[model samples]
Target chain A: MVKVHFTSHLRHVAPSDPVEAAGATVADVLTDVFARHPAVRGYVLDDQDRIRLHIAVFVDGTHVRKDILAAPVTPASEVYVLQALSGG
Target chain B: MAERLYVSTRKGLLVYARDAKTWKHHATHFLGAPVSIVLPSADNQTVFCALNLGHFGAKLHRSTDGGVTWTELEPPKYPKVETSDAAEKEKAPAVAQLWSMAWAGPDKPGALWAGTTPGLFYSKDLGATWELNEGLWNMPERARWFGGGTIDPALHAICVDPRNSNRVAVAVSCGGVTVTEDGGKTWRVAGKGLRAEFMPPDQQFDPVIQDVHMLAQSPSHPQMWWVQHHNGIFVCTDDLQSWDEITTAPISHFGFPVAVHPKDGNTAWFVPAKKDEHRYPVDGNMVVNRTRDGGKTFETLRRGLPQGQCFDLVYRHGLAVDETGDHLAMGSTTGGLWTSPNGGDDWMLLTAHLAPIYAVRFA
Candidate 1:
């Protein structure tokens, strides 16, 4: 089970705590997460089914800047969705 | 929770209060279009707001009784140009939109400065009358068009050293930071250690050198200042003679606003957005980072903010620190308005479902 933590603002649409997903890659796990939390799908993925520019995924504290969904994931890994922003 | 909050939106300004545990909206409707920037006097009695009206022209509005009422200030008119030779008539300086306004002293409350899309203007008697700072306009670089067409060099940010009225710094969008030692009589470029090279043949002009978005000065250290550029964040010392890069964060460099701790010179704050996207909140997530030791390091603080997809862009004048020095408030494009009393660790929404917020202030 990969520990997926949704932020406070996103919790209104998804499970607040970690969710289990039987997948081998980051994309697979996120696909399962999105299946459960439909409101969060368009937020992390674009209309073309690609990672959106503003959404950044992290696997085990390290940023998966490249093909986030395709990145490998393990049962012991953690996933975070951070907003890509610049100034205050 | 008992503190008062004020927010500026596309419709006007909204005042709010925290009751029990929920935020109660107090009032709204003060300006037209979007209130791009808002500044509250140090006494917490007077408020100033910059309204963006697109090509219709922009103006500033002021409130005297703690935002209870507001009145629009007359914008400065461009002086008519004339030629002594009488052979050719002179055209007046092009009128540009107003971008930002700065008041030099909250103690005296009359010394004010306003920056526009084309140049800088000053008013010693509050907002009653104004004069153009010719030194800034006369700079040979200001007349040079970096990319084929002429750029207006919009003045987006301005900071006046609280300790010294004569010491002031102004940031021009598409123009770098400019400082004046003996008041606004003479100006100099403070663009050392900042990237000036623009990319692509057509876009090959230095936007970072010219387009400065936000700036903050340490009340304790007059020589120290922090700047937010369209490209990155920077720290400068010795009156902007030299600068150090502090944009190592994992956020995009194209942001609009930056704020410093009211009492701590080493602590500063910035809101980050996704670099590759539309430059709005990343996937609609709201995140702000605070640097306790100046700009050397930063940690993300999003405890109470939303994480869903939202397109809220915090403008250059939206973030402000309270007078009590215990709270920080910000107005967003989508999230309405929020306040964090304990710096940025925890936040609470002060208003709901307001227009796109352009600026915020406390009075």
Candidate 2:
């Protein structure tokens, strides 16, 4: 099981509390999470299914960049979805 | 239960309730972010708030319980050009903020129209999904347009004809105005008779390049349109084919929000301020000018308003009148709220502190 947690900025869009979803990889966990709360899909990802520019996703405390959801995940992996503390 | 007012400002959203004799500040939402625009559905059960996060981009939040709680939804974003070229990003227009919003009416429940910087967007599924109206965005005149006070040219005023859902008119600051008869499919620039003093004398009346600050067409009178352009005020009496400038104001012709009487198309109210020089109230005195005979003459209403040392300004959506024109509310950039319960005859200060107000909508 993978634990998926959302940042405070996105909590209003969906439950921020970490949720458990069965998955062997980050991609599968994200698919499971998006399946449960579809409204967060657009905010976390763009129209091309790529992570939004300001959004950062990490698996087991390690940030994932290009292969957003391809990172391998163990049962104890913790996924964090956060908006980068940024300005431009 | 009294009528409620929704005020959006640079700081947040403020809600107020008014009874027979007094106004009460009720609640505040989005405590920190700049809430540039907000609209309450006719039924008052649902409200949509547009927040402009400086670096995070634009966001839209909906409140089902009269603004007590909000659910952030996917806001309108600049469309990704279908082109696979890497340069597509540089050419795409940037969406600065969701400056304005309106309901498509009960005929199409959950349908919404959003007016944003650089273009317009429409949502059929209650803001969950949005599609940019590329027809208006692709016009050749876009390259020549620019913003006045705002950072970028925007579709500030979206007047949807209640009589015909397909007929809609939008006003863009520095980009003039456009009317779409096919429900956002195709658009025609409709700035006839309006003049822009800032433009070169040769192109002042071209209609497409005029600096239109605001546009208002009362729901009761769909054919009668009023445009508060940057240079002067105009009224369209011939189905938008042409307009007549209302040059009878006692003060400057430049202003922001123009509130038309809900029932009487000939009657309207406007806030007069100095033009590009200062952008504050004319003569450093705040006053509301109302026209009852189609702008033939404007009676100045400033009974309880600040008489001297008042320089607050009103935005395009900052002055609003409820279903009954008698209940008028206006907010200022200096965080002042004023209400006229007797149809603009007399006014009273509601509050003097909040934030730089962006919009005032009475429900």
Candidate 3:
């Protein structure tokens, strides 16, 4: 099981604590997280089911490449989803 | 005159109400969000705001009980493009902004029309769900639409005929004007006689590529419409079939917004600014040009406006006229707001420090 966490901004949309979900890849982990907290899907992913351009998703402290939902994740890894620090 | 005014700004949505003859700030919503446009429902009971969130994407909010509270609605979304070409699939479009919206005429209280960048959307249940107007989206000429001042070409002005709800016309920034008679099922491009100086001489009058800044239709005369084009001012009397350029303004004709009188199609107002590269008020003086004889002559009104080194720029949706046509309100890119009680003859600076105003509408 991997632990998934969100930034404060995402928490405002769907309040949550760090959650543990089982997945071999980041895509599966997000799918697992979205199944439980449906409202966060639109904020994290766009209409094309890809990570939003300004949203940063990190797995086990390593920055995931854009649209790279297939990156492998360990059972004990921690994934963090945060908004990019841009815009005024 | 409208008792309430709504101003959509770069930072938030500000509401103002008239008390006895003076306007005062009433409320503010989405304090830190970029509100691109605000429109009240046909009854003026429900107000809708479109926000361009920097990170989360475009969002829509509704307030039925005035501005006290708001409920987020499902914003319109572009369908996922199905293509095998990686280049085409990677460049799939999204709703970059909600440029304009209108109530789906008087009879269809449950329906609303939304104009967004790249396409138009129709909502049947007060914005709970939206369906893209496929007819306008699939038009082959859309490939020639390019961004005017925005990253993507935007469908900014929507005019629904007051007499018939099914007949609607929408103005795209660089896609000219498209009209539909059978609701959203079918559409035709109809911007004729509009000249584009930016294009080559041979393609200057192409209807599909004319850049229309804003479009306004006289409420009493449904067939009379006014357009603030990138080149200059144009008026259409034979519905949307053709337009006639008006070049009699005393001041520079380059501007964004055009407000026509509700009761008289012959009266209209526009804020003139320097052309193309320089967008500030001409000669560092802010002025409004009013035409009462169907654009044959113009009166430069600046009695209450700044005559010194003012650099205010009114956007395409910044100037609005109330139902009575006697009251007018305009907001500027320099965070200035002004109101005129007797047309454009005189103006009063309501507030000079709000935010960069994107649109202003009376409620």
Candidate 4:
């Protein structure tokens, strides 16, 4: 099981917090989450299924490279999908 | 018949309904999101609002209940390109935001065309899926169509022939205008009368390099088109094949938006603004430059609009005309909203303050 949390900006689309899912990799977990909440898919990724420029995903408190979205995950992993802040 | 106005600003959407002769602000939606484009369907039953979500990326919301509720739809995006280099892969073209949108025609129902930063995209199933027009993308001349308004050259205007769904014309901010008679299969330059003063003297009249600001066409006249370029104004009557320069005395020839009268092809309106260096209205006095005889003579319309230290400059896609051609509305960067119910004769300011306005559409 993995714990996934969406940022506050997406609260209108996703209100409940810290949903639990079963997956072996980040891709698996995201696929499961999207299956439950499909509206969040286009908001976070382009039509080519690539993550947007300003969006960032963290696994177990560590930033994962966008090119490697298939990173392995465990039941204890905490996934945070948030809008990265780059500038003031 | 009734009239509704959709005002999309930097902050949200403002809908105004006209009851009899009095216009009242109806409702507001998408409170804090950046709404760039508001496209009403041909039947005027639905409205599509393109929202630029920071972390969530670009998105589209459909309102079938007249701004009461909305449903999410697939947004426009470029396809994935296979590359080995990590840095090269990171720099691939993607849809930063939706700059403008238009329906293909009344004949081709549910066909939507969207213009973004990278290029233009077409959706057949009403935005369920989108495909980028590689005909314009794979052009060898695209490399020279650089950006002048922002960091990246953007596709800003789309003009679809009301009679023929296949014939289309699109305008890019700094890439001039291109037309295709067979839909999106092939395109050619249509900027014969346009000029780019920023370029060298010899390259001023070259191909594929004019900063076209706005593109408009009257629904009743299917053969005529009007364009607002950064340097001057142009009109095309040959199905976007060639353009003729059309600006006379008292007309600045420089503005952000160009709107045609709904029923008359020769009638059009523009909001005058100082071109470069300072982008405000002429001498801080806001005036609408209008022409009834194509572009032969221009007249200034300013009855209730602000003058003197009023730095309200209209943005591209900020002006719109209702289906009756008797109503028109515009929004300014300084958050001023105004409308003329008597065909540019008299004006009424709806609100003195709103966010920087992006688009105004009649529903």
Best by TM-score: 3
TM-score on alpha carbons, each prediction: 0.70, 0.83, 0.96, 0.91
lDDT of 3 by residue, B68-123 (tens): 77888878998888887878867998887899999998789879989998789999
**Highest-DockQ candidate:** 3
- Report the alpha-carbon TM-score of model 3 versus the true structure: 0.96
Residue B39's C-alpha lDDT in candidate 1? 66
Name the regions of candidate 4 deviating beyond 4 angstroms. Answer: A21-32, A47-50, A58-75, A86-88, B247-251
Candidate 2: the clashing residue pairs are none
Give the per-residue lDDT of model 4 (tens digit) for B1-363.
446788888789888888877679888889877898988875557788998766677788887766677888878778886877767666787777898888888777888899998588998887778889888788777888888778888888988877787888888888988888899898888878777777899988765888889888777887788888887888888767678877582637678899998789999998888877688988888899888998898889989988789899899888888878878898999889998888888888989889999989886
Task: Quote the TM-score that chain A achieves in each candidate.
Answer: 0.86, 0.88, 0.91, 0.89
In terms of lDDT, which candidate is stronger, 2 or 3? 3
DockQ of each: 0.01, 0.14, 0.69, 0.55
Provide a comma-separated list of chain B TM-scores, one per candidate. 0.85, 0.96, 0.98, 0.96
Stretch of 10 with least lDDT, candidate 4 chain B: B245-254
For model 1, how does the per-residue alpha-carbon lDDT over B142-163 read when each residue is reduced to its tens digit? 7642211124667767888787
Tens-place lDDT digits, model 2, residues B55-90: 456788998988777888878877665775646643
